[model samples]
Target: VESILDKENFTLEELLDEEEIIQECKALNKLVLLDAHYVLNSLMFSLRDRAQVEQLLRYIVEEPSEDDDSKRTFKFPFIACEIFTCEIDVILKTLIEDEEFMNLLFSFLEPNRSHSALLAGYFSKTHQEVLRQLVDLIGITSIMEVLVRLVGADDHVYPNFLDVMQWLADSNLLEMIVDKLNPSCPPEVHGNAAETLCAITRNAPSALATKLSSPSFVARIFGHALEDSHSKYGLVHSLSVCISLLDPKRSAIASPLMHYFRNQHMYEPPIPVNPETINAMLPKLGDLLMLLNVSSDEKILPTTYGELRPPLGKHRLKIVEFIAVLLRTGNEAAEKELVGSGTIQRVLDLFFEYPYNNALHHHVESIILSCLESKNDAILDHLLHKCDLIGRFLQTEKQPILSGDNNLPTLPAAGKHAPRAGNIGHITRISNKLVQLGSSNSCIQAYLQ
Candidate 1:
């Protein structure tokens, strides 16, 4: 984007290295280093020539030939956009207050233009962090105001910093954000995109649900989640976005993947997922879960001689967590699938397989608890009679510390069940969940005891 300014003109990098940016920005004396002074003086001098930033903005909006798309046209504006990111008070203050600057910036985002993609780049990993740091430096509300002042110009758009919400509601912005949540993108891109999408959802619980709940979107995201070779963060971020779509009001707060439903103070009704989407993804996700159940092993950490990673199905933790979210949201289709496909039974096996992965414990606990609380007789019947819920727990409780013992229905000669730390609480929660069922059958009472 900045080829024009690389050598022919000058680069801020040539003057001030990254580590010295803050110090240079604060050097009120301005006469610090010769290189810095020279570069700043030259850049300031050009600010008078055709109004540098304004002209660059215009250049950015121009369409380039197909072959020329890779270079040249984008040079100056991207350079200027990046420069604006530096803590340069004079340029930043002027740009923020200038109506023309804001308009020019927004103009870069006009429909059917390359500028949209260019501007979207700012939300990538690095820029996302910069925005966050800016918020920390100047609170959220002020940052929101500052964003409008710095980026938008139309009276309608700049009046409120929720300008994004307007765009999200009016046009294809939300779709673009959703598109970025795929495995093809970098993990950080997916993470930042998911965060942005979640914020938009919180602002409108059901307004955009139909768009997000589309089968294609669900399949793409879930497909990425099951991808064995993609970066873990990318998959987890996609799952996070998926959960937000399913349960818009579950927990508006963006927490860790495993902690998505925790830290809640108020009850929020779960949004209904599109039945078509649920049906489409259930079999695919269940198949993947089952594959991981068999393909993955529970070998302890390896030494320098072997693979240093956890067993193959490590991401089962994320998949299981995702399923836990679905169950917790009372997704009827999901419950039926878990029971009918024997997925819930496998998930319980997965829980014991990775005893050392305490996070998996919580996910497993959430899943079982959600099921017991669901009160769906078929699912409950499968768990109690066919799945042998009580027998499984009792077997796990009594299984000798046998090595190579992975899950229920199998116990090797010597092993340690990692769930021993919380077995008592686990049993209590099962009993509590059963009590919530409000059944007074003698067998249920005995099982509780």
Candidate 2:
């Protein structure tokens, strides 16, 4: 097969002849699905005219009817992809330089259109230089949405896709992505827009730092999405972006990005609480606990069989884990914000709610250690007094342990009983910290005794 394929390479004359095959296929209303790669490769370089390119693009975009025998006609885009991967420079120059071809190609992205992902995947695989030219012709936002869809829909990683993402960052296209994340846009659009922003920031942090250096730019992009009441998934995307920007490794923009997240609350009803909104908001520790304890109804609870699931269930645990990360920064401002936001109490509530959650226990322990390590009186006061930290710990520790000897159904060992061991260790450590903070306090003395 390799030898046959090697011998079958089309020469210029053979390519010219294959053009007649394209005409023959079209005249008979038949698709050359089987020989698409050969047909496209043969015709690609030879057909450089705008009219010719548009015709090829139309073949890719046009949908055959359900009743038609040529339903697989949409596979033309895959052939186009093969051609793109092989003769990218020649094909890209022809497509990017011609507005009609570019427009026709982009038309495949409309939501109602079939085979949009095929078109997008092919477009994402173009050369970086060609990608820049393509974006210039089709506009960055439109192209970004296409790329975002391609990335989100498939698990496969394409190097060309990463190159295009880097190009967008280098070209300063973050603002274009921000513009697409408005509340008026569809949820899918918002999701893709946010995903694109995240991809750029995650893959190319230096480029993101350049954008984040501008307060207005950060506010315009990340801040705007946060403040848009109707931006559901976009808000989640923005929060994820914030988490990336705030990484201590990328401290260049961390301080300013933290400031934006801390103060921006123009949208209401302030923090989001319900499952749908929680899934959308992608809350961090400060955001999670503050919003959770706002009202009794909004509090986080343990997962129960037959109960309606909270949107942030497992994701919530991940957010709680971030508390330790924020504290690790020793960003005094962030620590103060967490203490002031009533998050410590909420953290305790979450710990108690999911007693089997060993991961949550570890995170709460980190928060306790950080506070003890900081010796910040404000944090101490909130934990000890306002949040009644010791009392709750004592109450949880005193709760009766269920056992099989009573002939009662034991709470499943893998689920409900998993954290009981961790709970004892957590209580002992907190008691030790309280003793060190002040043996003089009656509550501390009593808990220790």
Whose TM-score is greatest here?
A: 1
What C-alpha lDDT do the candidate models reach, one value each?
A: 0.54, 0.49
Tens digits of per-residue lDDT for model 1, 188-275: 5666666655554444433344555678767776776666544667667777767676665543544433352452233334446666
- Which candidate comes out best when scored by lDDT? 1
Give per-residue CA lDDT, model 2, range 1-449, as digits (tens). Answer: 12222454533223223324344323222333525555444344345555555655665566656774432444454444444444334555677655456446545544555655655555555433344443333334555545543332222333234433344455535555566666566666665565555554444334344454344555555444446533445555554455444442332243433433442342212111122222222333343444343223333233442111232344345355555555644555556777777666677776665455566676687667666555356765666677777777777677634222212111324344422323666677667767775665554455345
Give the TM-scores of the predictions, in the order they appear: 0.58, 0.46
Model 1 weakest lDDT span, ten residues long: 410-419
The residue ranges of model 1 lying beyond 4 angstroms of the native Cα positions read 1-166, 169-172, 206-210, 227-231, 249-280, 294-299, 302-314, 399-422, 435-449
Residue range with the least summed lDDT across 10 consecutive positions in model 2: 266-275
